[model samples]
Target: MRWVFLVLIVLNALYFVWEQQQPSVHVQQLPSVLNPAGVANIEVANATNSQTKTLDSVQAKINLTLLLGGFSDPALIDSLSQRLLSLDIDVKEVVVEEVDGVDYWVYMPPLVSRSVAVRQLKELKARQIQAYLINQGDMQNGISLSMLDTMDMAKDLVQKLANLGYTAEIKEVERKQKTYWLAVNSRSERLIDESLMTELTSDFPLMRYRQEMPQ
Candidate 1:
């Protein structure tokens, strides 16, 4: 009985060794979750990179202010500002007064009363002579003939008034000149467009411009 039991045990051990050397028949597949998760993460990272590039592109465009100036004529400045407004551009107008030089004012001495000044003004106008009555200041009730740049020009005007049977004198005064400017703000290339520049230069020969960056 003991011999038979030993033979049986030896046979069972040999069977276990044979099973360990054989290939598996009932194989189970993995869920493939890790590969899909990795792919999803990579896609999210790519999308984030794309968004960063888009933001960089937007940030690269600069907003600038263009200063258009060198204009002396008020009428021309008005025309230019209106033209720019029509193009849908943002524009701000600024008028600057500067001391140009001295001027000579040709006028008559103060009259006795406001009534006399008004009568003289009407008479001058009726005679086709342009004159203004000074209603205020030290020259109140006086007659203004013209504003001249030099004493010689004032004397000429005085002589002309004398020939018209009126007395005139000259006084020196400071001259103030006005300059017009436009500040245009935009983020596009419209400020430096060739055709627009050509149009502006053609219309206003003295129109000039410069650029100012934002802070």
Candidate 2:
């Protein structure tokens, strides 16, 4: 009777150990993808071929080029790079170049245009569209300002130039280091007077002015 009881206790202990070693039935949680409402369900299967299968599907990598503009803060670059790396996507290469008067960071990924780059940039909490001017010669002869306070001020400056029949165009508006740079266009001969420029500047203290001369 004593031997039978000992044998039963040993069998129960072995059964408990085997149960602990079995695969868990509880599902493993995964990180959320692009969509918040969607949840992914994973199923594992053993195959005769001993190849490892990943839980998440590999997405097509995007190619993007980042233009940093006049903003030359090293902290900004590191922050941006780290944020990009944190995403599920892979960064191929980041090239820093200075073309004409502006600083640029060119990223070569599998992405097509700046719009796509901006979308990815939005994920990192920076949402601004940056453009590279191809013709550097056009930007040579000018005094450029560095920041703008409001869109209304930008519109006002453009309107004032238009009123003078100078045909000014606002190419782009960018904010850098708490200042705004407004890219403007007008005929090369029609020079902006100091008084008018001063008026525009006073009204929009934060505005930086730059001319994008016609090519």
**How does each model score on TM-score?**
0.37, 0.21
lDDT of each: 0.84, 0.38
- Tell me the RMSD of model 1 versus the true structure: 18.7
- Please, what are the lDDT tens digits per residue for candidate 2 over residues 52-124? 4332222111111212212244444444334334532233222233333322222223234446544444432
For residues 49-83, could you state the per-residue lDDT of candidate 1 as single tens digits?
99999987666545555778658887877888888
The most accurate candidate by TM-score is 1
Mark the 10 consecutive residues where model 2 has the least summed lDDT: 57-66
TM-score of 1: 0.37
The residue-level lDDT of candidate 2 at 42 comes to 19
Query: All candidates: CA RMSD in angstroms?
Result: 18.7, 27.5
Cα-based RMSD of candidate 2: 27.5
Error of 1 at 43 (Å): 92
